[model samples]
Target: MSITRRTFALGLTALGLSACTNQVLRTAPRGAKPVAELPADLRPTPNPGYTDWVQGFKSRAAAQGITETTLTAAFRNAGYLPGVVDRDRNQVEFKRSLEDYLAIAASDERISKGRAAFARHRTTLNRLESTYGVEAEIICAIWGLESLYGERRGNVPVISATSTLAYDGRRGALFEKQLLAALQILQSGDITADRLTGSWAGAMGHTQFIPTSYQAFAVDYTGDGRRDIWSEDPTDALASTAAYLQKNGWTRGVTWGAEAGPGAPAGRIIQPQEGGPEFSVTRNFNVIKRYNNSDAYAIGVGHLSDRITGGGPLRGSFPPDAYGLTKDDRITLQQRLAAQGFDPGGADGVIGSKTRAAISDYQARNGLPVTGEPSRDLLRRLG
Candidate 1:
């Protein structure tokens, strides 16, 4: 995840925002000084409340076994970042249709990059797959989505961003814990305070593991004695992601999901948006959800992984989004269906599995082709 946008993928809020916190310079090596401060104009206006909070937290951190030296390094120049709070407050909810999401998640260019990355990391990925029972392509897919194959791991100062969120008090405890975990990471000598930058939300490294998750799942894959997820070499980060999946019950040899066709295996069918491709997903699909907790996100990972491994695109036709039908139109359609004794679960504008099932049932009852698509024509028929 990019720090400001995708950083929340490490299970922070359901919004995938405000997930982790730490501090290190982007270009500095371990133990090096944090680089040049921001331009005077860009510096956040000093907030005495934030300063007080940091001071109190410093005491608490010391109580929690964080050494003074580590705290000093982590807190140097740390302050509230208004941009972090802005991104958190303005997160778009369910804004992307499945088609839109898939187009970006598994774009041809991304697929090409993924294939090259897969081939490049074949030896290490193969070893990880053999050892951890997680597929290399899946790992690569996450790498692709989280940071564009390490091209954009975020440059936010984890300490400042995380501290600002904690001070913001919307999800104070969570951010505090992340802040403490970051301190532990620093104390462990894994990465220096000068080099610990990540997404604005603090999701660090190649696959964007939050601080706590990094502590639990990060591995020293190259025998470097440090679980360095932020470094240029992606081996440790990739291994850590595989380890995280395996630890969270990613089954060996089990497909996450497959495109639904005739005689597809028995599993939960999830079509994130009406008229989009449907997938019959397995238990492993749920496992993927442990990372980002979104059906669209999990499916994107699975499909992108498939493409990376030479699989084809989804074999379903989907209507383009952005016709005249708005959320109110969808609610009206649902209300009409329910009034006709063909309940569409609820009148929420969002199309979900239950809503799609109801649409299919309504279509079948009317002797129409069972496409499970919500359309103006269908709404007109119901009216």
Candidate 2:
């Protein structure tokens, strides 16, 4: 999962150059105002074609029993945020090696806290497990990863973010639907407009549930007539996550998979592509994938859950050259390659086929192995 040189280059290309944007900032004039501080009216406007989308959102919210008072109160001062769109549209650089990803995502800090939380809330977790048929560790692992158990829910207003994304006309329909769901949540008095904040991409709550996800899966476990995923009490959020997995087909009792030790027989080895990484990947694992459709993410959740329950790290090893590279290093490599005209497509730090191809081309020209795997030796040549 290391970010290759090509991935980094693509990120830079997206920003109109193959250099680190942050570096450019450091060299800029000292008096320059930050992009985020510009006047509101001067900011990016909605695409004209999305007027219909706004109207549609209003209509849907009304039909879903969201009052006009709630909708107006939520969106009255909302404005388009082009920066949010830019951030969402940007591709992520998967530069963390499996070990690094696991270490951070399933770190000891998380495990210790998770164990303590489990002990304190054993009654609630056990009740949820029996009622919903979802394991406590999986729930806790997701809770830890999504917002560090509600310690850092994002500050972007869900209503405004979804409205802005909808108005931007790139996936307008999707955002519009989310906007309606958000209004419904407000109407139901589950969360007030001022408290409804989340990621710029519109996922909210301790578990980062999108508005649509809230509509479809939120649970009022405490029976207070509201599903309060954002409150200090995480009962609703945890229960909702469990319900989501259960509804999506979580198996009762199976591990996600463990690594086969290097010393094991050849038949025990799980190959990378076809039969790689002999993971147990139960039904719940698939449900986790539904939350974010990435093998790395699902693996992170599963592994973190195992760790919480006293499991250890993988015993087998990844490919020899696949050292976990940091995000910054991948960006550096991509910038270096693009400067030399290898054209890895932009400096995003993801090792896509183009990046691999660029690496192969660079290796062939330099009389190297042409294996397309990045290394310190190739980096020296590129430098």
* Candidate No. with top lDDT: 1
lDDT of 1 by residue, 1-383 (tens): 12222344333333222211111112222222233454332235588998999999999999999999999888876777777777666654535566656655777777999999999989988999998999889888888877778876766667787788888887688888888888899999999776787766787888878888888889999998999998888999999999988988999998888889975566899888897778999998888877777788788899999999999888886664464566567778889988988867566555555667888999898899998878989889989
**Model 2: per-residue Cα lDDT over 34-80, one tens digit each:** 33543453244666554565667778777877788997888765556
The CA lDDT of each predicted structure is 0.75, 0.65
Q: For residue 366, what is the lDDT in candidate 2?
A: 77
Stretches of candidate 1 exceeding 4 Å from the true structure: 1-44, 262-265, 324-383
Best by TM-score: 1
Model 1, residue 268: distance off in Å is 2.2
